[model samples]
Target: MRALRCPVVELRQYTLHPGQRDVLIDLFDQEFVETQEAVGMTVLGQFRDLDDPDRFVWLRGFDDMPRRADALESFYGGPVWHAHRDRANATMIDSDDVLLLRPASARGGFPAPPGARQAPGEPAASPPSLLLATIWYGHGPFDTPFVEFFERRVRPVLTEAGGEPLAYLRSEHAPNTFPALPVRMNEEVFVWFARFADEGRIDDHLNRLRHSAHWSEEVLPAVSQRWARTPQRLRLAPTERSVLR
Candidate 1:
């Protein structure tokens, strides 16, 4: 496969078993929701390995070369990160390595032009877009508070991250999917996509989201204890534009 030149470069690391994924989530959620925003970490994407159980992944970005380099330096070397880094490192198995994702839509944003622009009377063109998805089961009663969080917190954070307000949708309603790693989708999965002016905007949009104020406090409280057991996340860059726009 070709290396995608997505505008948003998602960076992640997957730790192995005997390692507590939820424990890591708990210990790092603050740094995740908070520090990422502060450190100028661009996108804060979360996910579960569909095929590999308990394999969790996170996605975030940087717009330019300097910002990307700076965020990494701050995350790995800053004093604010020391404790969380220690905890995450201590809890994980050695096999895990960080992964990067840049959806095709975003890739179009590279030095390459994102195809052609619309003609004068032609239907408005649908620019390529990418959706970051999180799937987890709704354990009955937790639904109310969770719903509330989705409305009040999650949406705004996503809006801020994207730098554009994207219409939110359900997995079934939106129904856009790529080959996911592997996991049972029983939970109240939430889906949202960010549209770019061109494919390249994807990375810039994500970078802004990591810097958003609401990304952490908005979603972290609702994260359940069992979250570690089912940390599923995936990203899809749609090949065909959905008619919803």
Candidate 2:
């Protein structure tokens, strides 16, 4: 058979069951790392819900549609692939729950920008936790060098400062969009979400950029290169989330 030709890019979100998540998490880690090394594939990232272990999101970018189509059958339909798909397919394979998303840009990271973050002090409800998120759009094309600089310089600043990285997100354009998704979000976008304690911490988190001159020289430019070309960048906080528990 001739190879499939996908004109744009592809984004896929695979949701797993409670019992199946751990198994698939391990599989995806190995699988993603391997896939990132393949031709036309770049920027692989993953996200897991803070409140729920069963819910997770991952993003990967492909240069062409043909490789993307062949990849679907190639990855999931392969011999070892059943371990991840078989369990979920038994439940809600076609449900709106499991999906491939193409945001307006490529970075379908975070909660899609709730836009309204509650004030610092509000009436206390049970389990008071402020979900702090910062989503970045990758515009730079220098994948290998950027990842290295990140590992050596940027990532340390984050970890050293007590920031919890929820996920690193990357995506490809999807020709189709679901009713839940905005139609304009049909292009490549890259993003990642992280949570913080509260307002002061969130403020300080942004301030970290100023402290790291080394980080600035070595890292920021790398990410900026990837982000500049992307169409959109989402920066949002939820005043109230349904608490995807």
For model 1, how does the per-residue alpha-carbon lDDT over 1-245 read when each residue is reduced to its tens digit? 23333234443446656547666655554455556547765433354443445555555555544565566676667676676666776666653243332332221222322344232235536644454444443344234455456556665666666544332222221111211222223334333344455435556766665665555454554555424346444443422212212
- Predicted candidate 2 versus true structure: per-residue lDDT over 75-172, tens digit per residue: 55555456555544543222233223222222222232223322224432333344433444444332444445655666676666565544444343
lDDT of each: 0.45, 0.43
State model 2's lDDT. Answer: 0.43
Candidate 1 global lDDT = 0.45
Q: Show where candidate 2 strays beyond 4 Å.
A: 1-126, 138-153, 177-182, 229-241
Cα deviation of 57, candidate 2, in Å: 16
